[model samples]
Target: MSGRLRLSLQYKLFLAFVLIIIVPISVVTYVTTKRVSRQFQDHNRDLIRSIMEQMVRAYQRYGTSAVAKMEKASHSREIQEISARLSLTDSLGTTSIFEALTPEQITESAKQVGGPLDLDVFTILTGDGTIISSSHYPERFGYKNAKLLSIAARQEGVPFLIQEETANDTILTVQAIQRIALDSATKSLIIAGGYRLLRQDFLELILSYGKASLLFYDIPKKAITRLPPGRDGNPTPFAQSPDLLKLARQISEWPNNPLQPDSGAAARPELQAEISLGNSTYMFTGIPLIGVDGAGLGVLLIGLSQADLYRLLRKMTMSSTIAAAIGILSALLLSILFALRVTRPVKELSRAVRSVALGNLDQTIGVTSHDEIGMLGAAFNKMALDLKDNREKLIQIERVAAWREMARRLAHELKNPLFPIQVSVETMIKAEQRTSTEFSTIFAEGTQTILEEVESLKSIIKEFSEFARMPKPVFGPTSVNQVVKQTLLLFNPQLRTIRLIMDLDDHLPLIMADKDQLGRLIKNLVSNALEAMGEQGSLTVKTHLGSPKVPVGAGGTSSLASEGAAERASGRGIEELPALARETWVTLQIGDTGEGLSEEAKQRLFTPYYTTKPKGTGLGLAIVQSIVADHNGKISVDSAVGQGTTFEIELPISQPSLAGTETV
Candidate 1:
């Protein structure tokens, strides 16, 4: 298992993916939940604080209008008419002017000053409290001991906020109470009105921060408010958890220490904080209300439940998850495609190797890619090519080995009988052994024929033996022009009949070549040329140094230069040897206007034992090819049956040297 584990890139890649993204995501989830959520909560609280200040300013403005209306109505036309009709004595105080004008009349008159509302709008002075109006159903009119209202009436800059309660029952209402002067009277009246709980403006302030709901409560005063209760409109109560209630109470009493609590102090709650009310959780935040004299009046509360917070969180979470999934899937598909792209060259190399294993040495896998894997693929392709080349060399070597075996057999088979024939012919050539001049002539002919046959056998042995054991090249600098000249000079005895034309470049650079083998190469080409010419044609010997100047076709040589360094080194695996071959080449083209060879003959001309002539040993051009190849050169033939032949040989020209000893 461990060994298999060691070889997998997939496991390594997975580890990389985890390291790069998953671990970081874990960290982010922790920090965002721990640190960022609370910060968001703080931000929301600041917003609430700002809203509280705005509310204070708005209420202050509203208070001015309410106060002004009450003052003006005291001195208005209706009140003066009522006063005249009553005919009360001057300076009479504490008069009950109720029978003349009802509550409806007061509401009508109040509407003329402000906007319209409930019809039960009237003012009454009780023993210790005063009532301006009641939106609720209540009848206690003449006297009610209400020190809450009385204390708020005298000496105030802003209105006082107080909780409203029924005489015998606990009424959950918050009241905004204030004292106002009627017609500059030295005595003042306290006015109050409110509904049963937190107003619309405060609920709206809590709902604006994201989708969270906040609920606040007072532990001491036990004051609480829940907004937007549920889908159906109903108020939800605060939950039974002490910690939550405590936090809510703390929030409600903000800007004041609830335990000791500063005077005229208030505190607002943070946004995104959740509070449970009833069975459901609500989110909200609130602060304590302060009086105009910097005194702590009571705790102010606000917030909603938890259902909506989860809904918003799920929405955002789903969107981000889908986006992340799409990104990962795209990466997955791309990774598969890229892996295939990376592995294609390797697949080709594998196929090529299989082909080679099956003995098909001719298959080639082309180069691809530029990265490390691509480089490796290129190297594998090179190995395949080398394998193919070595296979071909082995086949060639085998063929040469088989030819040697055949030669050994043939030489052995004919040796004994040919020796007897020579002995008999030579004995007959002696005068005593001959019966007449005719016998002598016949004897001479027989001996000559036998000697010629023996010489042919010797030539056959020599050719195959030389081919079988081609000598290692002794590399040195040599001039190709001189080699060509010497080869032609070796045929100098026959130079009399053949029209020999020599054209050679003077400055052909020295090339690394085998001296004796190169000389033999030129000799064989000249011999083939002479043979093709028979006894009477022009033999043009041309020598030069250049790119593929050899009369062999330019097909393979040009590919060497164009295919670039690597292919040029291998010479494009061309069948015919290239003149310049692996480096600089000296070109020798020997043309003979003789009985030219056919296309078929040209193809097989350099092949060992493949001959067109009846008496020809067939090793002439074959040896030429072998020697030229041995020197890292090439040999080829071009011919027309009647037009004669051209033997093109390219040898790596080295320093010029004298010819070897002639075997006469």
Candidate 2:
């Protein structure tokens, strides 16, 4: 069998507990982790969308404020005066305008208007897109500002953002243009006012709503710039990172551009993605920045750090694992305790059963509860009680039956002798009445017959007396081989007609027994073997130092001999035999090749006065059993009709000290 199948009940119960407790816990943890992860992602997505929307609204508010300021600056008195002068008509009665003042005077007027309105660029332009005067860029006073003029042609006094190239760098500006007509022929002068869009100001405005970093993707240049939230460092680090550049390109292609004018009818959801930068991760969303003319200016990326969320998830998983471990351990402990609690009674009951099997009918178990185990304990106790009671009654009945059998046999034996004597005396009386000679002859023959019958009766009575008064063994060290040899010496004369076989073990250990009784036991067994073999048979005697090959049980004559031995050894049961006593036993066997006994005869062979031979007094074998039993040994007969019989005896090598024994 596999090791798993061989596991004891306790381990099996522990595994059951693990499956019942830990499996569900693991499953629940897995499911809950998945649910929580999904929720966190959904919540993060919603939060990022909210932040993006707020950022867009803030940008819109700033733009609206800048446009309002530019509009206010346009209607200023200084700008109006500059526009009036720049729009002076020529004397040719045409719509063409002229510069009515010196360039220095026009520049001074642009500065006076721009300085108070906080404008970054204030310029006066001709109808043909030439800058007449400039506040922020005086060097470009006469330059043809083609980009501004193109926007001016399209503008209707509404403010819009545009990128302007200065001598040093490109800058984004929010500008508004207003026209000043000189005549009816469409010749006009323009006044343009705007504020510069600085990177630091843009980032500051974005950071006002949340703690997130920003990245700007300039669509035209195909470049990505990192806009840190702080105001001190270089706000725009135009580092050309390939990974960031790739992300920016991907964002630019997203269809949901929030700044698209046509996107108002559809949902302008932010395009979101995850990216790892250095050792940290970020969740980024893209919001496109489109100009008023529907031209793509750039994409603005807002990123939120995801390190805290990851840490939280890790903590949750660890906590669940710890809890599950504790639960499994607790379940295992409980299972062990429960298994012990459940199996303890069964173990006790099993031991009690073994004790009862060994002839100890007084065994019992404790019943502590009303559960099934407790009920089993109660049942075992009841069974033991019943067995003990039944055994006592059986022993009483057996004693009664034994006495009745002995009485009947005694009566039968006495009747046979008495009948012969009675007939002999009656014949003597009849001869006495006939004649002196005949009477004398009859008297002599009758007296001899009567004497012979009386002698037979005396022998029968003597045998019965010896069986009834068997003596306690005086235990001492005596060699079993020596006793067997000595006993066989008495049968040497009868061995002449029979083949004598002696297989005595020279190494047989000395046993503690009464020498006289031990010799008598061997003698009786040998004598019976000789008589069974008749005139032409074999007689075998063997001695060994071990238990019988086949186990002898209580159902055989061996068990009866053990019971008798136990009764003689202080009225103790067979179970009371010490372990050492049983281990050191010596075995002796005597066999004869004669007409073996039948099964029925073998069973009753040890019963007193139960003999099979026509003229045999069964007390011979009965006395043999009694002597062996007195020495606390066992005897059995292996026999079958026509096959011969063998009597085996087992005696302890060294008997334990009893109450009155001098040597043990």
Candidate 3:
């Protein structure tokens, strides 16, 4: 948790914008693409089903036209004459139509009628369903046409599909049967005619309507035949495509009573499936082809290529991705611009506040807008101006109060000396007037007392003048430990009866200070300590590098290095203080195990002309305070009534030049 990174306003804003813009766009693009792909697939399925329906309609029309042609051929003169002859009986009842006409004449007659009708097969059947004469297959003359016989018995003049088999192959045809009336003694004769339906031709016709593949399932042979585009050869077996095979099987298993031609069963529902062939995929619709008598002939599968639809979807997805990227980039750019615009004023305000904290109380910042930031800037400027004015007034009041105190203390000291001098001079005048023998002695003593008192007044005046005329510090790189060691030498003889402890850090860095002024400050503190200790207590002095005091918890203090202190100072997180301001300090502490001063005495310890000593002029600690302040340092004292006293001073390792000092 302590190692967590701090994010600035600009980056936070950028992230927010990215999530807000990109998330919805991504979601919408995904959903829309999916929906479009699904719709495209559905449309393709419908198209395949529509194509199959068109083929079925075409086949029905072909069947209807074929039936009409056969009906027209039934009434033709050649067919009528052949039927009339077939119905005619010989004089002897045992002779039939076959005996009445030669086989050549009978077949030739059927051909003459079938040629104009454009029929593939024209045949005359006996009452028992034997092919008496066939126009297309003369060799089938003796074969029985059982399908025709049953269809004739049910209903004649209606077209129905039939399969005629030969040694080489099988042929499918749409044929209509017609019965011609004869005498009661002679049985009725039947005529059958139809046009041949080649599977290849039918597939070709279906393909001509659209760009699709056709698979014909032969129910009898249990085989699926594939008719691809632009192939003129016979259809090949299509066993590799499992999807198409499944569709074929599903259609073939559809419930229907094929034997009941007139049962009026409901039409089968169209089935659609998708199959892949080679590198391309297709959508197939299975259409069941029904024979005329409602028999399950086979399933005709029509497939429409889905390559175009897939290609379109791919293009759409690519387009969507590119668009999303552009949108995100645009959002990023806008977010950056916005974040900079917003944070610029905040950064300026921060710098201004730092300047104010560093004692530049006249700091002012520009107000660019009427927004919250601008309002804050305006408030800060006002506060700075007010503070500067107030500080000037307060300084003036403090100066007057200090001068009043100085005058009162100086007057008090002057009164004490003036009284004695006045008394002595008066005594000397009386002695001279009396003209006694002891006049000389009295004069000598009075003169001596007067001189001594005069000297006392001069001494008090000199100390006051020195304190008032204190000079500004000449800052330079000076080692605090060296100065403490040098000053301690002056008090060595006086410290013979006292236990002296010195803890000076060797690694302490040099501080910017006046060497002479630092010597004086240390001398004053040591003098005070020796005076308070008198004869027996220990006097201790220490010099070391010091860090800022940081608050650890409630009512607790912890010391940390400059870097850590600066970071801790600004609770907003990382360090906000300038590097120079956060530099380390050198500390000097001097303590005495003497009768410590009371709290009131400690409070006014550095005040000028305040002293606890009977004959002391209290300017030493005050002078020390002034010197410390001149070097941009701080001083503090910790004391108890009887536990002793200690003075701690902290000075920066380096500092900017003093405002009115000459650098050495």
Candidate 4:
């Protein structure tokens, strides 16, 4: 689970989409389902009320017929005869005298009475409001029921009236009252009667209304009776719908005031609740059953199965799951495609970088798009081309340096014999012009000049040979400062007009170098300085040890870093230079207070056979550069027009031993 939770970008995005798309859908589905259930409850309540409304109307019609029958019975001839005899015997015309009637007499009289077939209650009441007898409850003879007496007393002169009453037996009924007049004498006796609400017809009427499971709760008795669904003869008993009945029972117990809708305040009955019974679900609700006079009799419970609702919700869930699956699948596929589209170019660029690392500067990638990746490819190609150009330049520079060395040697070799030959020929000519001059003297002088020129030729050849066959150096711990001091001592007398300044650091460390070669390098720089000063200017030679913490440029050693980097890149094998070059490097600077060189001359200052002076061979500085390079050192010149020139050289104290190293 933890591993799965470690999210990649694509999966994280997919989860985000799932939440965005599926969460709202799930919430909406749940809310909608709840709303639908509420609607079902409200609609069912309305339906049950509609059915109850019709049931009340049916009960009212039954009461009306019973009232009509009671009224007719009161007007019968037999009832009139009895009322006349009774009235003649009472002066006040008080019907309370009828209390003397026995229960057997009342039962016998009602047997002969003609009235409604379903008369639930037949009673005789006196004019002063006393129940003489009730055919249904004959044991209550001579008793007074205030509810019945009130109906009899309130019947002033009206022919008949109806009222609702509940007897001591808890039988709820609607009664009718009427007076029997004995032939217009204004004398009469009151008769009251009613039909009980517990009749089978009443229950049948409610059950016939709808398919809702019904239960009649007897409020007074605290008993429950299920009104079986369908017709009376239908064998399907009410118990078959136990789930519905169970739900109905539960709804009946909720807080309710059915008799007076607004009379009581408890928690309003739960409008709807789900109930499970025998593998099925049902929605339950309740309605109050009240008597005609607004007395709460019982509750009418109704149950509606929830099978259809579940089916609807299940279908919705399945559809949503499938849709979510499709959405996530689509997101995953698109994310994969997008990741590949972005990474493919990066991989190609990586390969190109590797090619460059392996010194293959010609490798380039195609710029397929105008995006950042394409821009990178274009930049890579430009870099490769630049490197290729720099390599070619370095190679050309090496060739020029080689050619310059060869020309310097050739010039030196040829110039030697020519001077002497010219002098010898001139001497012979002079001899001929003087007629007294001896022929032998002319031959001897001419030959001697020629021989001298031949020896000079040999010396020039030896110099060339020596340069070409330069001996190697023998390394040792030599003081560079001491070498510079010795070279200054040798040239101090020769430099008659030149003012010399020596700023050498006595604290410089010993370097592994050839003293003879070091002396030659310093002599060449000193000679050039004197010559550039035109026989009368200051010459400065400064020597110091470089600091490790100092950067190359700030310390006048940047020439080594830049040029060494180029040489290393060109495979010149300068990588063996000591890492302590910064701190252990011995720096020498030669400055001349004379006419400075132009930029072109500075660039070719160390090129053999290239000189700015009329009598200069140019090999002097060239030889100095070669000696410094052989010691694994760097040399550079800084010059500006009209300002003097300065030559700086840096040599390491220790370097890797070379094969041809030898000491003089």
C-alpha RMSD between model 4 and the true structure: 15.1
Q: Write the per-residue lDDT of candidate 2 for residues 196-295, one digit (tens) a residue.
A: 6544565676666454767878899887767752354433665566766676776666545463234551223445667777777777776766565667
lDDT tens digits, residue span 304-391, model 1: 3445445555654565566556646655655456556654555556555534432344455555557776677667657767875775
Q: How many clashes (backbone N, Cα, C below 3 Å) per candidate?
A: 30, 0, 0, 6
Candidate 3: global Cα-lDDT? 0.71
**Tell me, what's the RMSD of every candidate?**
18.1, 9.6, 8.0, 15.1
Which pairs of residues collide in model 3? Answer: none
Q: After superposition, which runs of candidate 4 have C-alpha atoms over 4 Å from their true positions?
A: 1-6, 20-24, 76-105, 108-116, 128-135, 155-169, 181-188, 198-211, 217-307, 322-664
**lDDT of every predicted structure (CA atoms):** 0.53, 0.70, 0.71, 0.62
**Given candidate 2, what's the lDDT at residue 25?**
76
Best by lDDT: 3
Provide the lDDT at 643 for model 1.
Answer: 81
Give the TM-scores of the predictions, in the order they appear. 0.40, 0.54, 0.62, 0.44
Tens digits of per-residue lDDT, candidate 4, 1-664, equal: 2233465555665667667777877888789878887786676666666654555555556557766878777766656555655665533222434543433555555534534345767776555545554566655645656655554565432222223333343555655667555443644456766665536676666556444555555566555556552354222333334554454455455444333234442223345556665676765566555443345556555556667767887887788788778877777776677556545666667656644443445666777778776787778789878877886797589758766767765776577678778877887877777764486787787898898878777765664555556566778899988888888998867677788888989898899898998898888888887877876889888888873233333322223322323332222223232354346577888999889888677666776768888744456776777677667667766677788888887776775333221110
Instruction: TM-score for candidate 3, please give it.
Output: 0.62
In candidate 4, which residue pairs clash? Answer: 95-126, 95-127, 473-661, 473-662, 474-662, 474-663
* Model 2 misplaced regions, further than 4 Å: 1-3, 9-43, 89-112, 120-124, 131-147, 158-161, 172-174, 191-202, 229-247, 260-262, 265-270, 314-318, 321-363, 368-376, 383-664
- Cα lDDT, model 1, residue 645: 72
Deviation in angstroms for 518 in model 4? Answer: 27
Question: What is the clash count of model 3?
Answer: 0
